[model samples]
Target chain A: MIKITEKPIDVQKVIDTASSLNAGAVNVFIGTVRSKAHGKNVVWLEYESYESMTVAEIRKIIDEASHRWPLLGWAVSHRIGTLKPGEVSVVVAVSSPHRKESFEACQYIIDEVKTKAQIWKKKYLKTGRNGFQQAHK
Target chain B: MKLKIKTFGITRDILGGRLVEIEISQPTVSLLRSELTRRYPDLENLNSLFVAVNNKYADESEELSSTDEIALIPPVSGG
Candidate 1:
């Protein structure tokens, strides 16, 4: 499963979707907005993506990961629009018969998304000293 | 050849729009990256950069085509 959405990530839904009878292990990684960036206190985050293409790319990632690892299931979801501090922005889930594949798939999703996926985020930060910056591209 | 580059996140805002035009003969990914860095020196200094051609992560040396979906993606450490 894969999606680029405006709704908050449903962590339980993702986990449920990835679980199967034969699978003994499941792993998930959640990314959320933080209140700081490069030493400034962040007020929020702005996330966006090229909607259609992003979705396609994410699905491709899942397809490849599942094939390469032979995992029972995998899902990735990323949130768009504005998010306040401590909001879940992205979630990834993977399940397999053992812990190793689950863990590897989870890490694979996060690291690959960082470099490969089209999703982008801007940190809206306000510093302790009252300074500000929008960290982006 | 000319190519359209779409930027987002920090790069889009810094470039002040989502797309920009670049003209090159047989453009390569490396040329695009250097051009962007040259045009926005500050962005060059600000974040780690990656180039993608047609929505896939690409090597800077990869050959480019005008029809390709090109993007300049920076490090996204945010939530």
Candidate 2:
């Protein structure tokens, strides 16, 4: 289940998908609007994807991550559009026969998505009259 | 051939939520960017933006086909 959308991600739905794979253990990672980064409050985040390209790349990323590790199954979903503080921005669910693989692979999935994938990020810093800035590509 | 590129985030705001199509005999990322930046002066700071073709992250060297979907992804907020 590789999904990127503007709606708030349904964590349970994705977890249910991973659990249906019949793996013994499932590890999940949910990234929320953090309170502070660089000493600034994160007001909100506006996620932007390159539309179709982003979806294709996200599926590719999941495939690549799954191939690189020993796992029964995994799913990654990202939320686009305007996301306020405390909303889920990203979610990764991994299921495996053992705890070790599920834990390791889940972490790796997030790390790879951050660097290897073509997705970019804009941080909405909280300051008087301040809006947003491109964190990186 | 002409390729339409969708803009998102800041790019969309700059472009006023409209699609940009540029005519190109041979559409490469570099050429497309140069041509697009020229036509859309509002997107001047978007030179560094990533271009997506047909919803797959595309490299600058990729050739553009008429049916391919293109977009300008300004930045993401995924953690």
Candidate 3:
């Protein structure tokens, strides 16, 4: 499953979808909003995306990763709109017959999603200003 | 040709809105960028800016049409 949504992501759903009898290992990566950015206190975070393009790009990344790994299943989901600190922002789950392949594929998916996906984040600072900066820069 | 461009993040603030319509004589990605930077000079301050046409990242050399969907993609910050 691949989706961009306004609601909080269900991490368990992602893991369940990627779980299968053929898989011995299931790797999950969860991204959360940091309480501080650049040493400044963060009040909250707002996420936005070109929805159609974001979903399309994620699908492409999954396809590429699947080609390079012997995967059983995988799921990627992102949350948009307002999110407070400690909230989950994104989740990536991958299952494979071997532990190494699942771990590698899960890492690759999140890294690619960070760079290639069209999602953007805005940081609401406790200083009463909103800072919009690219993530993973 | 007339083009509708979608903006996000700081680009929306720089453009002063989520969408902007611009009229151009030449229909190419590079020409559009030049026109945009000419009007909104602050856009040049960004570390990187990308143009997407019809939901795909487009090259500056690619030709554009009036009906195409164009979006200004600033450096992405997603995970």
Candidate 4:
């Protein structure tokens, strides 16, 4: 399953979608907004996405991961719009026949999503200023 | 031809709107970038900018049509 929505991510739903009867291992990764960034207190974050492009790019990443690893199922859920601190923004889950593949695939999915998906975020700080930065340096 | 380009994130901030229309003598992605930078110098300073045509990252050599959907993609910050 692949989804992008304005609503908060349902982590449990993503995990359930990734669980397969034939798989012995499942891994889930969650991403949340931090309270502080660059030494500033974060008040909230506004997320934007090229919705159709984001879904397509995430699907491509999952397809690549599945080819590189043995996988039974996978799910990706990403949230958009305004979110407060500690709010969930994204979820990635994968299931495989073994623990190693599940872990590796799950990590790869999230990493790629950060860079490849057509999504952007702006941080509103307590000082009445906003900052735009990448998820990773 | 006049093309309406969709802007997002900082691009929208710089362009001052979600969509901007421009007339270009050449119909290529690179030329579009040149024309935009010529008009909006702030866009030229962005660390990285990508021109997406029809929801895919378009190369400089790609041809553009007036009807194609185009967007400005700055460095993404999603996880």
Interface RMSD, one decimal, each candidate: 2.9, 3.7, 2.2, 2.5
Per-residue lDDT over A1-137 for candidate 2, one digit per residue giving the tens place of the 0 to 100 score? 88877788999988877773567799999988776777777766666665456556667777876787667777788887777788898898988878888888889888766654445456677666755543432
Candidate 1: list runs displaced more than 4 Å: A50-70, A128-131, B23-34, B46-48, B57-67
Clashes of each: 5, 5, 1, 0
Off by over 4 Å in 2: A20-22, A116-123, A129-137, B13-18, B23-27, B37-49, B57-67, B73-77
Pairs of colliding residues, candidate 4: none
Tell me, by lDDT, which candidate is best: 3
- Model 4, residue A55: distance off in Å is 1.2
**DockQ metric, candidate 1:** 0.35
Consecutive 10-residue window with the lowest summed lDDT within model 1 chain A: A128-137
lDDT of 2 at A40: 74
At residue A52, candidate 1 shows an lDDT of 64
What is the TM-score (0 to 1) of chain A in model 1?
Answer: 0.91
lDDT of 4 by residue, B19-63 (tens): 999998668999999999988899977789999999999999999
lDDT of all predictions, in order shown?
0.79, 0.73, 0.91, 0.89
Model 4 error, position A11 (Å): 1.2
Task: Rate residue A129 of model 3 by lDDT.
Answer: 60
Q: What's the CA error at residue A60 for candidate 3, in Å?
A: 1.3
For model 4, the docking class works out as medium
**Would you give me the overall lDDT of model 2?**
0.73
Give DockQ for candidates 1 onward, in order. Answer: 0.35, 0.35, 0.71, 0.68
**Model 4's lDDT to the true fold?**
0.89
Rank the models by DockQ, top first.
Answer: 3, 4, 1, 2
Tens digits of per-residue lDDT, candidate 4, A2-70, equal 888898787899999999999999999999999998777877888989998998998899889999999
